[model samples]
Target chain A: MSAQRRAQVLLAILAVALIVLPFVSGSYVLSVATLILFFAFTGQAWNVMMGFAGQLSLGHSLYVGLGAYAAAGLFFHYGIGPWAGVWLAIALCVVAGAVIGFLAFRFGISGVYFALLTIAFAEFTRIGFDHITWLGGAAGLFIKVEQRDTWDLLNLRGTPKMFYFVMLALAAGAFAFCTWLLRSRAGYYWQAIREDEDAAQALGINTFRWKMLAVVISAAMTGVAGVFYAFYYNNLFPEQTYHISRSIEIILGPIIGGLGTLFGPILGAAVLTILADSITEIMAAAGIEVPGVKQVFYGLCLLVVIMFLPNGIWPAIARRLGLKDK
Target chain B: MSAVNGSPILEVRELDLYYGDAQALDGVTLAASEGEIVAIVGSNGAGKSSLIRTIAGIETQRRGMVRFRGQDIGGLPSHRVCELGIGQVPEGRQVFPSLTVRENLEMGAMLRRARARLAQTLEEIFELFPRLKERERQPAGTLSGGEQQMLAIGRCLMGQPELVMFDEPSLGLAPTIVQEVFHTIRRLHERGLTIILVEQNVAVSLKLAQSAYVLENGRIAMNGTGAELLADDRVRQAYLGL
Candidate 1:
């Protein structure tokens, strides 16, 4: 078979496997699969800004925390449903993204400076949330969980299997959206800007507008992930949600898989989540209570990937498989 | 209408630029008439590139006006300036490195004016550079310097610009490729592109230009017909080594 056909068949098989996975697995394995899909979705969102548009954002947790709080706050206080609250979350995140994008791009802050600015904004938001006593602040916010035998899709309160399917849908939907985006006009403009801003400008691309668009879209997509996070986890904490470590976790999948490719983030998330979970399980079984062992494993994986696959594992894998990536 | 009857297609008046308290261009003024080749010759750091950058709207002019077809375009963004139909082949062939040659050309036709006839423009570009067509799928970075230059010029032309600016088109190129570049510029002039040619190859630019300006220390030191400046003693002493 041709390489393209082989790739298509491989994709089909993978799709079938994911769809049937929850049925064959226990609750623990199902939860891990859901976690992998969550990371894959968020990683793709972050990839739009840094990988495609060449704008590095080291503090993407700012959006996630903001989205989570905005939706969770409304849902907690006014008794609004999560489905209705998600739009508010998206709007809030887009506004935040616009503020950051305008300040950075309009004033000519780029590269490491841009990355630093994102972190600063996220840190400021985290600190501000800590002081705001109404939304539980640093003490954390909790959602009222009810015991129900039936599925509640509208409220996002359901069995573990239902949450897993929803997350799977989200991951699949994001993948499809990114695929369309990469082939769209904005996608070409983003890649052009990423390659060289000056050259893109000379070719009649409005660099500032396009860069802002990338951030807005990326922020909105990440907002959806935040909604999922808030609903599934049933709680929100400023310390845990908006921390720099959370932002690092969101970006790690894309970095380890591949920066700009479609399937790289998904592969990276699956590999990282499965391995990390397995290690944690093994350590527990052996009665070895090592602190931050998961983090150490992640660091080791990153080191190995950077040393052996500088372009990330996806490109090397694609090359070997004769699949067109890019 | 005014542009058709022998008025300048691009005009710069008393332009000035500075970089952190250092003046790079001082009161530099020049014009390129429609269907004319205007060569700008200067030594290193004489603000030749700065002038082109300012006209292309990459650099903001500190104190002067840049008019395109009598429209004041000073201080506009680079993309807005481009959409107004001014195209540039930048100093070093800055084609999108990882993009395929065809994709690079496609990026140029992204302007609204050029978008409607993208296929036609692509065909014309391929016809203009058969080698580019031959290597359509190859990454631009993998191409040789001369081929990359052709791709740059082709990319610029894909915008369907009424006027095109060339900035040191022959820099870092092999001798034969330099000749090929000059030949392409001459062909483009014949095809009715109002040309602004900036070059260090003094004699050849003057020979190809209808009018030319000599810039020194961010100022217009001399202005005359190409032949007049080519034969002048000061021009010969400073740039030509004659």
Candidate 2:
């Protein structure tokens, strides 16, 4: 079979396996799978800006936090469902992305400077939310538990199985969206801009518009992930949700997988999440109270990956599987 | 003021460009008519590249007007200039290295007008540079310097630009490869395309050009027909080793 055909077959098999997972796995495994899919979705979103457009944003949690706050706040106070509230979350995140994009691109603030700007915005928002009592301030906010024996898909107060399927659907959607984008005209332009900004401009690609589009689209996608985070966890705290560490978690999947490839983020997230979870379980079973063991393990994994597989684990895997030529 | 045909297709009037506090171009004025080959011959740092860059809107000029097809396009951005039918083969053959040769050509035809004729233009470009066609599937960075230059010119042609500017097309190439590049430029000119060529190889550029200007110290030092400048004493003393 052709490389493309082989990839299609592999992806189909993976999808089938994921679909049948809940039938065989217990609740704990289902929840871990959901977490892995969540990271995959957010990592794909982050890849649009960093991997494709070559813009590094270390403060992506700004969008996630804003999105979670928007949906949870609306649902808590106004009795609005998450389905309707997601629009508000998307809007807020897009605006925030636009503001940052405009200021950064217009003034030629790029590279680490642009990353610093994103961090500053997220930090400012976190501090601002801390003092705002209307949204529970720093004390945290919770979604009221309703007595629903049946699945609640609309309000997103569903069972673990329901949430698992929802996350899988979302991961699939994000994957499809990224695949489509990489083949489209905008994708070509993004690749050109990412390779050389000045050359792209000479070829009649408005770099500013394309870069801003990447930021806005990435923010919007991450916003949707934020909505899922709020509804799935049923709680939000400014520190926990908007933290820089949360942004780091979102990016690590893509970085460890492969930045530009479609399957990189998903593979990276799976490897990271499963490994970390197993390590925790192993330590727990041994009754060894090791502090920051997961962090140390992640750091070591990242180091080994960077040292050996510089482009990421997915590209190496793809090459080995004959899914890609190089 | 001397236009080959009627009105000039591209006209630069007293363009002054700067990089920070340092002046890169000072009162450099020139023009190229439709279907004419105009060469800017100069030594290193003579502002030949800067002149074309300002015309292509890659560099902003502090003062003066860049009129393309009779429109004032001085302060416009590079992409806008490209949209207005001006394309540039930048220095160092900046073909998207990671992209395939076909994809690089496709990127050149990104504008609405060029995109409409993409298929026809791609065929034409492949016919002109068959080496590019042979390596269409390979990444552009893998191509040799001569092939890369051909790819760059072919990519610019894919844009269907009325006016194309080449900056140092022969730079860092062997004598035989430079000859091939110049031959390609001649063929392009013979096909009725307006060209603005900037080069340090004065003799070869002047031979290919109809009308040529000598740029020195960010200023136009002299202007004349190719044969006239070739025979001039000042040109022989400064550019050609007499």
Candidate 3:
């Protein structure tokens, strides 16, 4: 069989396994799977900007925070459903992305400087959100829990299994969307700009416009992930949602799996989530109290990956499986 | 220089470019008419690259006019200049290293006019440089220097440019490869493509070009027909090493 066909068959098998997982597994396992899909979705969104466009952003939590706050704020005050609130979330994030892109690109602040600028914006938003009484400020905001026993897909009040399925569908949708984008003209332009901006510009690509498009799309997707976070957890804390550490969590999947490839974020999220959960479970059973052990583990994994497989695990695995040409 | 009529396709008048306070190009003036291969030959740091880059809109000229087909295009971005039918094979053959050869050519045909004829252009480019066709699936960075140069030229041509600028096309290559590059340039010129070639290889560039300009210290030192400049004592002593 051809490498592409082999890959498709492998994906089909994996899809079947995931679909069957909730039926065979218990509640805890279902929850873990949901977490994995959540990270995968967010990581894919981040990858579009960083991996595809070569724009580093260390303040992605800004979008998540904005998205969560927009949805939760609207739902709390105006009794709006998250479905309606997500539009506002997307708009807010796109505007934020545009402003940041304009400032960074116009002033020629790139590389680490651009990254720091993103962090600064996130930090500023966090501080502002902490003081905004309309959104509950530093105290945190909570959504009213519904007492309905039946599944309410419209209101998003349902059992953990329902949530798991919703997350799975979202992850799958994101994967398909990214795949389509990677095959499109915009995708080629993004990759070319990523490789060398000057060459891309000389070849008639408007670098500023394309880079801004990447930022806007990526932010919008991350905002959707934030809406999921708000509705699933039913609460939003400015400190927690906008934390730099939370941003790091969103990107870990793509970094660990592979930066530019299609399946990297999905595989990375699965590997990181499962391993971290298992490690936590093992430590808990052994009567060990480790604070931030997962963070330390992530750092170790990143260090090892950088030292060994610089392109991340997915490329190497794909090569070994004969799925990618050298 | 022999008097040739009709408006120049590309005209740069009193262009002054600066990198901070250091002036890279000082009031440099040159023009190229249609169906002419104009050569700009100078030693290292003579602002030949700067002149072409300014004309292509890569560098913003603070005090000058760059007119392409009678449209003033000074200070327009590089992409806009390209959209106006000016393509450049930049210095060092800056191909998108991670992209495959086919994808690199596709990027060259990104503008609307070129994209409309993408398939035909691809076939033509492949015919012009068969090595690109053989390595169509290979990443561009893996190609040899001569192959990369050829790919760069082929890519620029894919844009269907009215005028193509080559910046040091023979910068670092074997003598035979350099000859091959000049031969390709000659073939392109014979097909009636206007070209502006920047080179340090004075003799070869003069032989290939109809008219030539000599730039020294960010200024136009001399301008004449190719034979006139080649016979000039100052040109022979300074650039030709005669």
Top candidate by DockQ: 1
**lDDT of each residue in B1-242, candidate 3, tens digit only:** 42374688988899999988989899988889898999999999989888888888778987989999899999998889999899999888989898999989989999987889999999999999999999999999999999999999998999999999999999899999999999999999999899999999999999888889999989999998888899999999998889
Candidate with more favorable, higher DockQ: 1 or 3: 1
Q: List where candidate 2 sits over 4 angstroms from the true fold.
A: A146-149, B231-242
Q: Least accurate stretch of 10 residues (summed lDDT) in model 1 chain A?
A: A142-151
Better by DockQ, candidate 2 or 1:
1
Off by over 4 Å in 1: B1-5
- Rate residue B54 of model 1 by lDDT: 89
Estimate how well candidate 3 is docked, as a DockQ score.
0.74
Q: What local distance difference test score does each model get?
A: 0.92, 0.91, 0.91
Say which docking band candidate 2 falls in. Answer: medium
The complex in candidate 1 yields a DockQ of: 0.79
- lDDT string for model 3 (A155-268, tens) is 778888788888899899999988888778778889988998877877888888889998999999999999889988998988999999999998889999999788999989
Model 1, A1-326: lDDT tens digits are 88889889989999999999989999999999999999999999999998889899999998888888888898899989889989999999999999999999998999999999999999999999998888898899998887455679988888988899999999999999999998999999999999988888888799999999999999999988998899889888898999999999989999999998888899899999999999999999999999999999999999999999988999999989899877
Q: Is candidate 2 or candidate 3 better by TM-score?
A: 3
Interface DockQ of each model: 0.79, 0.75, 0.74
By TM-score, the candidates rank as: 1, 3, 2
Docking class of 3: medium
Q: For candidate 3 chain B, which ten residues in a row score worst on lDDT?
A: B1-10
